[model samples]
Target: MSELLAIAGLDCSYGEVQVLHGIGLALAKGEVLCLLGRNGAGKTTTLKAIMGLIPATAGSIRLNGRELTGLPAHEVPKAGVAYVPQGRRLFAEMTVAENIEIGLMARGKGKATRDMVLGLFPRLAERLNQRSGTLSGGEQQMLAMARALCLEPEVLLLDEPTEGLMPSMIEKIRETVSKLRGLGVSTILVEQRVEAVLAVADRVAFIENGRNRETMTAAALRADPAAVKRYVGVG
Candidate 1:
């Protein structure tokens, strides 16, 4: 139960426009830690900082006690972190298999790793030859997640994963997250749905106005649904 990914006093910005201020998070191995806040509350910025996609001007991001603050964005995955951004970014013209192959390139994963991740999303398996851009919204999300899993990451950063998905797709995404937990993959989940947040989060941290607000056990938060709305911006 040791911390696998840790972020302390994180600060991020876009050309001097700071979006995060002293954000901190700790994700233990095999645990799901959710980040809650309103739009533009620095939730996604925290995740990007952790992934090295956005530079952190101040703070520490460590994985397994190893410093990751200055690691290159491309090297972050090799260091055991995989990120699935909110948009499901994939090569529009690439086949599903090709997209996954690109993910495999991060850590030099091969057929076994490819097959394992593909197994997680059988729909993606069925569409291995299909172009990613032509897939449905839900399927694109699946591919994005499967692609990240190809890195066999110790920590997974999921940003609004269930957004715009159907009920069935949302359930599938939740099921996949549960499976990842069983597989000992820690996750930092940024979600919009209160039910989904409760379903997967072992703990929830509130980020407010670009700073660390507080953290609580999911059970504690679930007992107070009104607080859940207030904290996560459910309105």
Candidate 2:
């Protein structure tokens, strides 16, 4: 596996108050790397920094060997990084089809592109005419991921994808992620569900007190329950 996304000595702050400290991680092509930690452990901030939602105060962020340190958030997607934020921020008033159209706008205007996205997420095919806000939580999450996929990203940054969903819904998300991995799309999953994270991740990185603590293969973390519980509040 080749390195696709790399963050070295990354740091970020909010108005002089630092939230991340010397955090670093890497994503390989076709791999799923999960970030595990309790709340306020700087998980979201790290994603934001990588996506350029918040500027990095120091260090480097690279995608596919291209330096992405100072790029703006909107430009990050063009560089092959798409972010599916925690809230599943879809346009409530927009129909599912219309919402997907908004996503197509990122890559370019093409009917084939629309077809590709709809094809990937067949569930969205059925709700094309329905308003996004009316969709269930799982469905909305699907829309969010589908919308980002329209950009045709090489790597996806997902934040707490299964946070507030039923077990069945979580299964759907897990299946979707697994399918994406098979298609050669690497992903960085920031999740609170330790079991699910370990189940889907190829590798795991633990972040604590705003810094990288330990990183290991998914198998190792699962085998050591005490290790998982120490940092992520789970075992």
**Looking at candidate 2, what is the lDDT of residue 173?**
88
Single out the weakest 10-residue window by summed lDDT for candidate 1.
226-235
- Candidate 2: segments with Cα more than 4 A from true spot: none
User: What's the count of clashing pairs in each model shown?
Assistant: 0, 0
- What range of 10 consecutive residues in model 2 has the weakest lDDT sum? 109-118
What TM-score would each prediction reach against the true structure?
0.96, 0.97
lDDT of 2 by residue, 16-77 (tens): 89999999998998899999888899999999999999999999999988999999788999
In candidate 1, what are the lDDT values of residues 61-128, reduced to their tens digit? Answer: 98999999999988889999999998988998999999999999989989999889978998998998
For each candidate, what is the lDDT?
Answer: 0.90, 0.90
